[model samples]
Target: MLRYGILFLSILFASSFDVSAAAISAIQSDLAVLRLCNASSPVSLQAVNSVLINRDMKSSETQTQDFKCFLLCLYVEYGWMDREGGFSLHHIKLTLESSKLPEYRIKKLIYSCTATEITDPCERAFNFTECFWSHSDKETSPEAEIPEKEVSDNQNGFYYIN
Candidate 1:
């Protein structure tokens, strides 16, 4: 479309802020995907608007089934969520890496919040967005130490050498 072409060409020029170019590209990409997903999902324009404006929609009463499905469509399009409701962590990490945040913080966020007991794709999408967003607001100190735990031979998908 002409809009995307214009947006794409605009990204070639530098912006005023340090991460403005990346931020702009990310935002533009999101908008394009959102519009495409919006067409296929049973969500309303109002629902999209509300969700975009309010980060607390997961807990809000406005989080309808349509809204959840819309979110799922977004994740699927972004390659963050697959057909089996599994998250492609590599894609997620790459997506987050686009942000201005440090690598450690992004990894920490993914590690702490990605695991869930939810089986439904729509529900999982909602949960993931809420989980990721909630923790993103709380700043974790880089100097903070994580308590070490002993690893078993077959724990968390890895075995100890010894």
Candidate 2:
């Protein structure tokens, strides 16, 4: 079910944080709410898995877009982000708390990746992910930042991996 999938995702996220077992269990319980929401329609489980598994490595623009879209799909499905791509601070706080991440890190993420300006949910999500990863502390985070110098976009709005 969706609950299990979300739990799996929580585990994947928590694994990056080196969290306690209690925190992991709490995240699992918290992610149960995702089951009541819609599933990710635009992204498949395979796509999600691929992104999560290879997030730390170099990836093509298409792969990056897919990963960002997957994250956006989850946000929309969870109702944390509106269809128009507006971010809810309350929902973000709830999710971060559920994940048991440090308050400072959560605040930093919220500050850096607020998607209020973006009108399209998908585009907003993609931009948010890019910002999140770019601003992340590589030593403390599981996913490394994509080098800005190496990232270039084409006319089609897709980034090119150099």
Candidate 3:
């Protein structure tokens, strides 16, 4: 009975590890694709606005619907979202160590920093845009700490969008 219990525990541990790794991999892959898009085009606030207007994107749905908007904006502004999306283990660590940022705030930052034209302060689309350079504060990055083994085990070739 003791042996059986130990085996069960081991299996549980392995399964947990596997799940976490897969999660990390998916995150990593998404980052990679965003990075690729950013590289393809230097993102700017104007560029994002153009895309948003063209696509009619909005800040509804808790701003998740705005992720692609943020991505395009980031690409227009900084020319890359995440330093090549975990190209190297060191790069991943650097990203991990950097200050944590709310996903929404980061998106807003990309807009403020990259906004080329700010003629209409009266009709500003989103208020959060100020957070970009309003202060130098860095929030915790989205990449939460997961076991290294788990992150590695779930390496994915492509990032998925919901």
The candidate maximizing TM-score is 1
TM-score of each candidate structure, all chains considered together? 0.66, 0.50, 0.20
Stretch of 10 with least lDDT, candidate 1: 153-162
What is the C-alpha lDDT profile of model 1 across 1-162, one tens digit per residue? 434443554465335446665777777787688767766665655555456556657444447776787788888887887644567666788888988777777777776655666878788888888788788878888865543333333422321222
Residue 17 of model 1 has an lDDT of 46
> Which residue pairs come into collision in candidate 2?
none
Model 3 lDDT on a 0 to 1 scale? 0.37
The per-prediction tally of clashing pairs is: 0, 0, 14
lDDT of each: 0.67, 0.57, 0.37
lDDT of 2: 0.57
Candidate 2, residue 98: lDDT: 83
Least accurate 10 contiguous residues by lDDT in model 2 = 144-153
- TM for candidate 2 is 0.50
Residue 32 error, candidate 1, Å: 4.1
Q: Write the per-residue lDDT of candidate 3 for residues 1-162, one digit (tens) a residue.
A: 323333454457656775576766664554455455444543433344443334333424213424444443443233232222211223323443365755444443443343333322211222223333243255544454422121221143211111
Off by over 4 Å in 3: 1-19, 44-162
